[model samples]
Target: MKHVLVTGGAGFIGSHLADELLAQGYRVRVLDTLAAQVHGDGTRRPAYLHPNVELQVGDVCDKEAVVRALQGIDAVFHFAAAVGVGQSMYEIAHYTRTNNLGTAVLLEALIASPVAKLVVASSMSLYGEGLYRDGSGGVHGNCERTLAQLERDEWELRGADGGLLTPLPTPETKAPALASIYALGKYDQERMALITGRAYRMPTVALRFFNAYGPRQALSNPYTGLLAIFASRLLNDSPPRIFEDGLQQRDFVSVYDVVRCCRLALESPAADGEVFNVGSGQPLTVRDIALRLAQVMGKPHIEPEITQKYRVGDIRHCYADITKARKRLGFEPRVKLDDGMAELAAWLKDQAAVDRVAQASAELSARGLTV
Candidate 1:
């Protein structure tokens, strides 16, 4: 059995990926720092993590830890990064150190101890505004909302002719428009891995994941995905607060589907040196997702509070065009949104989340990141 090393394997997506890898008969070892933001104030392994998987508690930025984790590992999945688009904006140095410098440390270690395969976890955030199409069907990948437009409460992308542009399925071909510090870090990580992998003759693949949510999400962390944030609010008997009229569109993919794609990338030669967008290939309005989650959690009475506010790096719409992943990696998202949300709701019943949305929002507003 080939041995694999998954960085940040104790976290939501990484832990699920570990379970999948272990079930497939691969010896899986995880290297993670167990950040307090995700795992609370403890250093012990997460109970949700598979007991059979070997866990190495360490930061990805630590050279010694990375080198130690690389021992006896045939392949590597670089999933370690500071997640949170909003948090990354104010905590610039923290995000840069963890996501960018950490990847550099990992890459240097990999250069000394080359792995057969390297799969880097990237994010769809890099694509600031997703592909848009004018009324005449002309595609616009460079469309962006100006501050003047945002100040006027104009949410949707507009063409030069002042016509409303429709959001299209964003493919890998769309040039990245890094909008936030978090996005810039993710882009740096992916590009760094690909460049290092190519130079060192290590087969590498980058998976630009959309909004991934499921069982192991950090619900208490307001900086997490939208679904988890909504769940946290409902769990606390508060209405889910949404920004910018709640019409912004996003693609939510199941963690199961994402890990399956990870495994496919690890095993498929065709995925080497390529970047694929991993998502459900379905778009749902933010308002729709809030209502669906509330219904699933048996809290339909708690309506979502639509705040006419906006975050600095917030995108109007961006969903994946999984044609590349489907055609290349044989990846197809199997979990429907309803089923996935139900499963998440079931898990949330037994979970306790501290309501930090208000605090996070206040911080952003204080920093003028929100309006």
Candidate 2:
């Protein structure tokens, strides 16, 4: 039997991935710090994690911890990173140390004790803005909204001729436009792992996940997935807050589908040394997602509060183009948006979530990250 180690496997996506691995007959071991931000004041083992899996409580940046985690491990899935784009802007050193430096430490250990395969979790935030098409039907990858445009409330991207641009599905070929510290860290982690894997002859795959949401999400953590944030607000009997008219589009994929893709990346020889976008391949406006979550959670009366304010690094629209994943890894997202939201709502009914959205927004506004 093959033994697989998943860094940060106690968290949302990683925990689910661990379950999938265990079901597939792989012995799973997890290395995680169980950071206070995600796991609360006390770093106790999450009850949701499979009991059969071996859990190692340690920081990935610690060389001794990483070295120990790699012992007897045949393959590795690197998922240890500090999340939250807004928090990353102010806590620069924390994100850099945990995401970038942690990956470096893990890669160095892998060099000494080479794993047969390495898969790293990447993020779609690296693409600041998704691909767009001008009115002339020309595709443009280098489109960005200026501060002046944002201040004027011109939310959409436009061509040089001042014509409005339509958002196109962003493929893996699109050049990255890193807009936040978290994104930069993710990009760095992905590149570092792939480079190290190539040099060491370890097959590596990078999965650029969009918005992954399901049960066991850190509901109290305000900086988690968008759906979880909205659910927390709804559960607290507060209106879900929408930013910048809330028409900004994003892709939300089910965690189940994401784990399936991760497994495919681990097993597929064709996925070696490649990066694939793992998302639902469908775009939904932020406002629509909020409303849908409310409806599913039996809070249709609690409408979303649309705040005209915008965050500095926010993107207008970005969804996935999953053609590469479909062809290479045979990935097909089976869960529809409605079904996923319903499942999340059902799981959330019995859970208690601390409402920290207001506090988080205040912190960002104080730092001038939100306007």
Model 2: CA > 4 A from native: none
Task: Report the poorest 10 consecutive residues by lDDT, candidate 2.
Answer: 146-155
lDDT of 2 by residue, 1-371 (tens): 28999999999999999999999999999999999889888889999999998999999999999999999999999999999988999999999999999999999999999989999999999999999999899999989988888887778899999999999899999999999999999999999999999998999999999999999999999999999899999999999988889999999999999999999999999999999999999999999999999998998999999888878778889999999999999999999988888899899999999999999999999999876
What digit string (tens of lDDT, one per residue) describes model 1 on residues 1-371?
Answer: 28999999999999999999989999999999999999898898899999988999999988999999999889999999999999999999999999999999999999999989999999999999999999999999998988888888888899999999999999999999999999999999999999999998999999999999999899888999899999999999999999999999999999999999999999999999999999999999999999999999999999999998889888899999999999999999999888988899999999999999999999999999987
Model 2 C-alpha RMSD vs. true structure (Å) is 0.8
* Whole-model Cα lDDT of every candidate shown, in order: 0.94, 0.94
Global lDDT for candidate 1? Answer: 0.94
Q: In model 1, how large is the Cα lDDT of residue 159?
A: 98
